[model samples]
Target: MTSTAPAAGAATSGATSTGTSTATSSSLSTTINPTFRAPTPRHSSFTLSTISLCGQPEDVLDLQRGSYALWRDRVEMKLAIYQVLDHVISDVANPADPEWLSLDFIIKGWIYDLITPELRTAVSSPGATARTIWVAIETLFRNNGLARAMMLSDEFRNTKQLENPLSVYIGKLKAISDEHRDLGYPLETHALLLQLVCGLHERHETIGKYIQTEAATLDLLRLRGGQALHG
Candidate 1:
């Protein structure tokens, strides 16, 4: 009976030890593995919208040397490509729209970069919107007096071939003619062709003479000749 009692007590002790070991493991697991999860970071404040517009337009708006018409067309085309033409054309602004206003300022910076220093000062005003600056530029160029037209005409008549290519010389004349035409004095087509023929380099004498002789029916394509000569 005494041996049997010791065996029974030994069995109870073993069972109690096993139960205590299981309880300790379960308590450690619960304490190590928590149910609460931390939040993920959003980074909303650090985020910024970006645009891909870089570099100045080829035709910078300098009235003394650059073509306004060409500059205006190029600027508009670039803005159209990036889908931001509305910023320069539309006067309406929604102050609540942060994205729209952000793009507007970006475009304004682009224009400021692409114009001449003289023009920059002329168009710049305190608190001017992009549209306002655009309109001011248009007014400055398109609303000058008769003296501007006269000066342009003089420049047109005196534009010589110099060391430039035939196409480049013609392009210069055409730009002047375009500005002149804008000011209500369109150069006659024949006169423009004559000016083009007269401004050719001495090396192109043969083609120049041919063009002069055929001036009556001279197609514009004749000026856009062999790539070698045009270049």
Candidate 2:
């Protein structure tokens, strides 16, 4: 009768087969060892290139020449920066990205530096200075419809004053507006004047209300044959 039990050689072969399976499993365990864990969430630093101020020379010369083209160029540059920042905010995943927001604030500060002194003189002297020409530029900013366009951008919507560098310039704008009112200027300049006031004070409802009240005094002058028709 043939024995069902394995012989000595067969038993030895079975033990070797079991030992080989254990070695293969141990090799896989070594090969699959963890290298590094996942990174934790943290703030990342970023950088942005500065915006160019094109057409500045032409605008400066035109200012001296009393040419509308110079004023137009200046207004265009201001609006262009505003528009570009607005687009950047929309394209980026994070609306509050610090680098992008800082660049926007820098551009705005440059514009304020370029215009505030001129604005101050114009508000003080009414119709008797180069600052009066600046009023036309301000009108271009508003009438071109870029101001409202900026307000529509995610940058404007998501912007927080505490995190924004532009907050300082905005405060400067409010100070300028307050100073203008104390200078006794009439409301005919309100459209341009209030546009600036509103641009800077948009975050403060009280300042906006004050601008509205101050702007209410503007009266249109009638012209007859290039001569003032209304007193």
On residues 1-231, what C-alpha lDDT tens digit does candidate 1 reach at each position?
246888899999999999999999898877787884566542221131354333654556775655567678888998876666777888788646767666667777778877878999999998777788899888888776356778887887788988987777877887787777776777788888887777778887887887777678664445655442344
The candidate 2 region of ten consecutive residues with least summed lDDT is 220-229
Using TM-score as the measure, which candidate wins? 1
| Cα lDDT computed for each candidate against the true fold | 0.74, 0.42
Query: What is the lDDT for 51 in model 2?
Result: 39
Kindly list the per-residue Cα lDDT of model 2 for residues 9-87, writing each as its tens digit: 6888888988998998887777786874555532222222343444455433222223333344555555554444332
The TM-score obtained by model 2 is 0.22
- Who wins the lDDT comparison? 1
Give the total clashing residue pairs for model 1: 0
Q: Candidate 2 — which residues are off by over 4 angstroms?
A: 1-58, 61-70, 74-95, 120-231
Query: How many clashes in each candidate?
Result: 0, 1
Could you estimate the TM-score for every candidate?
0.67, 0.22
How many residue pairs clash in model 2? 1
